[model samples]
Target: MQTFATLRTPQTTGLPARSGAGMLLMWLGIVTFYRIWVLPRLGITLYVDEAQYWTWAQQLDWGYFSKPPVVAWLIAASTALFGDDLVAVKLSAILLYPATAWLLFVLGRQLFDTRVGLRSAVAFSLLPFVSGLGLFVSTDAPLLFFWALAILALVRATSMDRWRDWLLLGVALGLGVMSKYTMLAFGASALLYLLLSPQRRAQLGNPRLWAAIALAAVLVMPNVLWNWSHDFPTLRHTADITHVEGINDKGGNVGEFLLAQLASLGPGFALAFLAGLVVAWQQRRDGRMQLLVCFSLPLLAIVFLQALRSEANGNWAAPAFVTATVLAVVFLSRLKTRWWIVVIALNAGLMLTVYHVRDIYRIAGKPVPASLDILKRARAWDVLARQLRPIFAAHPDAMLLTENRTLMAHLLYELRDMHLQHAAWKPQAIPQDHYQLTTPLGPEDLGRSAILVTQSGSAGVIERFSSHQTLAHVSVIAGPKLRREVDVILLEGFRGYR
Candidate 1:
C-alpha cells in the first residue's frame, strides 16, 4: 500500500515530519492556482446541476425546492466578485476544494500527527473525483470544507474543552448541513463516537456539548423555516428520493455502489481503504482508532445499508472520506516500499485520463466514443444555448416557455442578455422543480403569446393555444453517439389548463 509520497509517523523520541507540511502547502497552492486560472476556460460547459444552481443564485434565499441554499449562495458570491464569466460562476469550487484540503491537513495533524496530516491532504487532493470536481463546481465543495472543519473542531474541543472550539463545531456542522443534507451523518457519527468511548462518555451530560448541538440546530432553523413556509418542498423531495417510509428492495445496489468505489478511488486505493475500515473495526478498542472508525465507518455503513435497502449514490458518503483518507494514508504507509510507485502511477494515470481524455483521443487519431466520453454532459450545452439564442432574441416579448428544468436553467443562463424568465408549463398543476415552483404558467397567461421549447414533443399543443406552430427544431450533435434534440414552438393565445 506504499505510495510515492514518503509519510513517516513521528517516533516518540525521533524527529517529526515537519518537511511534509511545507510540501503539502506548496502542492495545495499550485492546485488552487491552476483550478482558479486554467480549468474554467477548458471548454467544458457547466453541468445541468451547476446551471440549475446558478439559476437558483439568481435569487438568493434560505432554501430551494430540492436542496439547501449554500451552493446557490456560493455561486452568487463568486459571480458577484468575478462578473458573469464562466470562471466567475465556477470560482467557488475552484477555491473551496483546495482550502478543504488544507483543513484536512489541520484535522489530520490534530487527530494523529504532522505526517498523517500531510499524507491526508495529498491523498484527498489527488482523489479521482476531486480532479474532476476541480472542473465542475457543486454542493459537495462547501460540504467537504465544513465537514473537515467540524471534525477538527470536535477533536480539538474534546481536549481543550474551549467554548470557541465548541462554537466552531456547531457552526461548521450547521453550515455543512445547509450545504448538503448528507452532513446529517456527522451528527450520527459524533453521537456514536461520544457514546462508545469510555473516557469521554461522562461528557454526555456536559452543558457545553448540548450548547453546541443546540447552536447547530439554531443555525439550521432558518432553512427549516423556509421549507415550512414553502410547503416543505425540500423535505418532501428528500423523502421521495430517500423513500423514508419504506425500502423498495432494489437489488444489487450495494454491489453497484461498491464497484462505484473501485471506479472512484481506483482499485488499489479502494481495496486498501476497505481493508482499513475492517482494521478500524478490529482495532476499535484503541481510543484513537475508535474515533476514526466511529466517524468514518458510521456514515459509510449508513450509505451502504441504504444501498442495500433502496439505492445510494456513490458520492452520498463523501464526507466519511474526510477521516477515511487519513486512515487510508496511515494504512498505506505501512506497506512495502516498491508498491509506493504503483499507487502513485495508478492515481496519476487516472487523473490524467479524466482531465485530458478528449486530447488523448485526438492525439490517438480516434474520436472518443460517446459511451466512454465523460465530458458529454458538460459538452453541447453551449451549442444548445447558441441555437436558442436567436429564437429568444427575436421573440423578446414572447413569454419564454419550457417544460424541463434543464432547458429552463441553460436557456435562462445563455440568454441572460435578454433577461428571459420562463413560464414553466406544469401539466400536473404541481411544482416538481424550482422552475415550476416560481414560474409556472398560470390562468393570467391564457391569452399571452409564447415561445415554447420542449425536448419531449410539440404535437397536440395546438389544443392549448389559439394558434400553435413549430418555429424550429434544434438537433445538436454532442459526441459520436450523443445528440440533443428539442422542438421550438410558437404559440399564440395560450388557453388555461383548467
Candidate 2:
C-alpha cells in the first residue's frame, strides 16, 4: 500500500501548514454559526417537504413512497437528541456542509495542490445551492456529504489498493444511495474512470474492489427489499419524475436544463466550472486530471442526455459540481484573486438574501409579490393550524380530515402536540403518497363524525357526508409579500367517508 507521504507532490507536501488548516477551520466556524443561529431565527417556516420528512422521522421507516429512508433516519437521530424542534429537524443539514467541505479539502489536496484543495472547499461551502440547503433539511445534505466521502475513498483506494479504503468507499456508496438514488451516478462515473485509465483498469481484477461492491450491495439490500414489497414505489416515482410515460421523442430539453443549472449554480461558479472542464481536457495526459474528469463529466453528460430525452431537474446534476468545484478552483487560482473573491461574494450575498428575504423587502418598504416569494407554501400552514386549534379542541372526538397531501403533512407536524387523529380522505383507490397509504379513512372510519377541511370548498365531499355545516371560512395572508390569500373552509359534522 502506498503511504500518505508517497501520495503527496512537492506542492502539497508542505501545503497543509498552519495557514491552510486555520483558514479551513475559520470558514467552518463561520458557516456553522450562520446556519445554527442566523438561519433558524429568520422567521421562515418549514417547507412542505421538510414537514413531510419530519413526519416520516416520527415513523422511522426503512423506505418511503418517493425516496429512500436515510433522510428520515437522519431526522429521527437529530430530533432524538434535540427534542423534536425545528432546529433539531434541521440540525443535520446545518452541520453536514462543513463535513463535506473538509472531505473535499482532503480529496482535492490528494489529487492536486493544497491551495487547490482550500479553494475548492471554500467554493463548495459558498455555493448558492449549498447555502440554500443549509437552511432546509432534505436528502441532499447526507447525499452530498457521502458523495464527497466516496470520491475521497475511491481516490485513496485506487491509488493505494488498500482494502480499508475500498471498504470505506463501499460504506459511503451504500449510505449515499440510502440518502438519494442519484448516488448511482457516482458509480457510473467510477466505472467510466476505470475503463478509461490504464492504471485504474488493473483494479478490475482486484478482489478488494469486488468486496467493496458486495459490501455496498449488502447495506442497500433492506431498502431494495422494502421497495420490492411496496411494489417498487420508489422506482415508480423516479420513472414518473423523468416523465418516461410521455416521452418527447423528437424534442430534447437540454438547453433549458443547462440554463437552470446556470441559475442554480450561480453564473460565476458555472463559468469557472466550464473553464475547469476545458483545462481538465487539455491536461488529460495527466492521470490526476483524467481521474477528476472521469468522475465529473459522465454524470453531467448522462443528466444532460436525460434532459434531452425528457426533463431534468437543475439539482439532478449537483454531484457533478463536487469534483468540478476542485477543477474550477485549480483553474481559477491561476488568475488574479479578485475573480474568485467577487464570485464568492456574490454567492454569499445571494445566500443572505434568501435567508433574510422578508426582512429585506420589509426594510425596503416593498412587498415581495406572491409570484416572486418562493417561500409562500411554508408561510400559511401555522396560521391555518392556529385557526383549527379551537375547532379541534371543541370537537375532540371528531377526526381531522383532508384530501390534500400537503395540508395533511403540514397539519401533522403543526398539530403534533395535540395528538390529532387525522386521515387523508382518499375517495379513489389509488394511493398518492405515504400518508395516503398509511393514514386512509377506511370502512372503520365510517359513521365517525369528522372535521373536514378543504381549500376547494368541499363541494364534492358534502354530498357523501350525513350532514354538514359551515364552521368557519378562513382567509390567510400567505407569504412574506402578504399579497395572496389561502382560503380554507371548515365543514363540521362530516359523518361518513362515503
Candidate 3:
C-alpha cells in the first residue's frame, strides 16, 4: 500500500482519460433516452409513489402533506414539457441520475484527475440501484442530484474560497433540503469535515462560509413557513415513519438493513466501500482523504443506528455514497488490475440484466419468474385503473371517496380525464397522510353523495352516509405476487361523522 503521506496527492494510475470522456457521455445519453421512451412501453405501469407524485404535480404548492414541494414541482415541470404520458411522469428520475453522475465526474476531476473522473462517472452510472431506480421517479432523484452538486460546490469553496462557489453551495444545499429532509444531515457532514482539518477550520472564521449558511437558511425559510401554517405535517410524517423516538434493540433488523444495502449497491462495490472507509480513516492525516471519510461516515452511521432503532430503507443513505464512490475508486485503484475488472464486470452485468430482464426472459420463451420481476408493484396498475374507470363513468354525479392512500392517489391520476370531485374517508382527527390532511370528507361535505372505494368495507365510513349500498366487487390479477380486490360502495347524503 502507498504511504499515508502519498494519500494527500492523487495517484492517477493507468486509465483512459480523453477518449473515455466521449464514450461516457455517449453511454449516458443512450441510457437516458432508453429510460425516457423505451421503459414506459416495457409492460410496466407507474409505481404508486410515482402516481402519487403525479397527483401532487397537478397542483403546485410551497409544501406538501408528507414531503416538501420539490418532488411535486419536478414532476409538474417534466409532465408540462413532455405531456402526461407515463414517460413524462418518470422523466425527472430518467434525467437526474445522469446529471448526478456528471457531477461525480466533475468532482473526481477536480480532486484527482481526468482518468479518475471518467471512471467515477462510469462506475456511478452503472450502480444496480441507480440504473434500476432511474426508470422510476421519486423524491430520491432530486435529493441525490442536489446532494452531489452540493458536494461539488463544497470542494470548490474549500479549495478557492470563491464567492460564486459559496453561493452555489447554498443554493444546492437549500434545494437538497427542499428535496428531502435527510439533507439536513449534509450540514453535519460539512461541519465534521471542517473541524477535522485544522487548516480548513480557519475558514470557519471567514465571512463567505457564514454567508453560505445564511443564504441556505433564507432559501429554505418558505418551506418552514409553509409547514408552520400546515401544523408541520412533513416533520410529523417523517417522525412517524422513522419512529426515531421509539428505539429498541433489534440486532436482526440492523443485519437485515445492511444486507439490503449490500444488495442495493451490489456486493462488490459495497464491500469495497466499507474497506475504503477503513483505509481512509487510517490516512485521516491527509485532508483529501479526510474529506471523503467525513462525508461518507456520519450519514451511514446514523442510518445504521436508525435500522437498529426502528427501520431504514436501503436507499435511506444514498447521498452518503456521493463521496463514498470517489473513496471506493481511490481505494480500488491501488489494488491489482483484476480487482478493478471484477467490479466493472459485476456492475455492468447487473445493469444489463436489470435493464433487459423482460427481453431476456421472453427470448427464452418463459414468463418473468417472480424472482426476477422487480417491477411487480408497477405491473398491471394501468389495467386496474382501467377496470375502475367504468365505475366512475356509471356514477358521474357521485363524488369519489377513498378509504386509503393508494386509492386516493392512483384514482386521482388514473381517472384524471373524468375530473371527479374526491375526498378521503378519514375518521380520526389527526391526519395519517396527504389525502386525509387536505381533502377528507367532513361535516361540511355531509350532504354530498359519494362512492366509497376500499379493500375492506369500512363500517365507520359507511355509517356516516344516510343510505348505503354495495355497488360492485372489483378484482384484478395485478402480478405474480399481487392479487387486488376491492369493495365499491355507493353512499348517499353523507351524514356528519360526530
Candidate 4:
C-alpha cells in the first residue's frame, strides 16, 4: 500500500510537466463530446437570439439592424448543412471552440512555457463560459475565437518581429471586427500596445501594421457602408438598449459585478484569474506578459466601471478573463504539484455543480419551467405555428400583422421549412413577407383582409386593429413563462371601417 501510494504521488505531482499535453487534450476531448454531441442530442433549442440570428441567415445581408452579418452567414451555412436544425446551428461554433483552445495553447507556449500553455488551454477548454457559449451560436463565439487568434498573432509578432505575424494579426483583427463591433476594444488596445512598447514601437514604423488595418477596413467596408446607408440605426438601437441616453433606472452594484464574474468563469477559475491579475499588477516589471496586462487592464477598468454604472453586459469582461487565465497558467506553473491538483479539483467541482443545477431538470423528467411568460410562447411555439398556418391559408391574399418583430421572427424560424407561411406586416429591417400593419394598412394592402397575430403582452396594440373586422379568434395557447394567449384573428368579414 505504501509503495502504491508513493507511486501515485509522483505521477500526480509530475503530471503538469510530464503529461500536461495529454491531460489538456483529454479535457478538450471531453468538451468536444459534450458540446458537439451530448447536449445537442438532448433537444436543446436555440435561444431567442439564436433564432433571430437564424432569421438573419435566411435574409443574407451585409449588416443587420443590431449586429454584423458574420453570425448570420455562419447560421445560414450550418442550417444549409443540416436543414435548419437547432443542433446544426449550434455545431457551427462548436467546431471553432477547439481551434480557439489550440490557439490558447499556442499563445501560452509562446508567452511562457509548455506547461503554462497546457494549463491555460485546459482552463480555457473547461471554462463554463466556453461550455455554455460553445453550443449556442452567437456573435461572441466567433468574436472570442478570432480575438484569441489575433492576440496570438500579436504575441508572435512581438516575439519574432516578423512582418507575416503582423499581417496575420491584421487579418484576424478584421475578421474579429466582422464578428462584432465590440472587437474595437481589442484593436485599439493592440495598436496602443505596439506604440507604447519600445521593443515593438519599431514595428509601428513598418507598413505591415497599416496594411493589416487597411485589409481589415477593406474586408469590413461593405458592412460599414451598409450601416452608414441605414442611418446607423443599429448603433441607435444598441444605445437605447445600453441606456446611454435613455432610462437608467438600474445602477451597477460592485458586489453584483464581482459575483457575476465568479458565475461566468466558475468559482475555481475565477479565483485563479483574480490571483493572476494581482500578480501581474504587483510584478509589473515582467516584460514578457506586460503587454497583455497593459491591454487587459484598461478593458477590465471599463468593464468594472460599467458594472458600477449599470448591469454589466455578461461578455463585457471576456477579454479581461482571457488575460487573467493566461497569467494564471504562467504563475501557477511555478507552484507545487499538490497546489495545482487542488486548483484542478476545485475547477472540476465548479463545473460539476453548474451542470447539476442548470442541466438537471432536463434529465430528471422534470421540464424546466421558464421564468418569463415570453418563454412559454417559445415553448408552445410549434402549436402556435400550426394554429397560425390555416389562418394565413384561408386569406390567400391577406397580410399578417405583428406588434413585435422578435415574436414574428420566432414564428418565421419555426415555420421556415413549412410551405404556407403567414407573412409579418411590419417595417422589416430584413426582407421578409413579415410586415407591420400597426399604422393603418395602405389602400392597396387593405384591399385584401389581414390576419393580426399579437401576444397577450402586446394585445393592447390590438386597439389599432379596431378598423378591421374580426372574423374569428384562435386562442393560441402558450405555456406558463409566456402566460401568453397569442390571438390569431381573421379579418375577412371587414365590417368595421375607419
Top candidate on lDDT is 3
Which lDDT values do the candidates have, in the order given?
0.79, 0.80, 0.82, 0.66
lDDT at residue 187 of model 2 (Cα atoms): 79
lDDT of 1 by residue, 73-149 (tens): 99999899888778888888878878888888877665567766776787788777677776677888899899889
**Candidate 2 displacement at residue 16 in angstroms:** 3.6
Task: Report the C-alpha displacement of residue 367, candidate 3, in angstroms.
Answer: 2.5
> Which stretches in model 4 have alpha-carbon errors above 4 Å?
1-26, 41-43, 253-255, 342-380, 386-396, 419-444, 457-484, 492-498
Candidate 3 ranges with C-alpha deviation above 4 Å? 1-20, 248-252
| TM-score against truth, every candidate | 0.94, 0.93, 0.94, 0.83
lDDT of model 4 at residue 16? 56
Worst 10 residues of 3 by lDDT: 1-10
Model 2 agreement with the true structure over 1-498: per-residue lDDT tens digits = 334455455573366546786889898888888788886566566788899999889888779988899999988999999887778888888888888988888887776678878878888888888887777888888989999999889888988888899999999999999999999888788887787767778888989998998999998999999988878888888888888888865567888889877866678888988898888888776666776787778888888988988878878888877887877787788789899898888888988887777788889999876676776666767777887788788888888788777877888888889988887887887677877777887777766677777767577876767677677766666754462233444444445544
The local distance difference test score of model 4 is 0.66
Per-residue CA lDDT of model 3 for 292-401, tens digit only, reads 88888899889998887778888888888778788888778778868978997898888778868889978999878888788787777667778888988999889999
Query: Per-residue error at 354 for model 2, in Å?
Result: 2.6
Counting clashing residue pairs in each candidate, in order, gives 1, 0, 0, 11
Best candidate per TM-score, number? 3
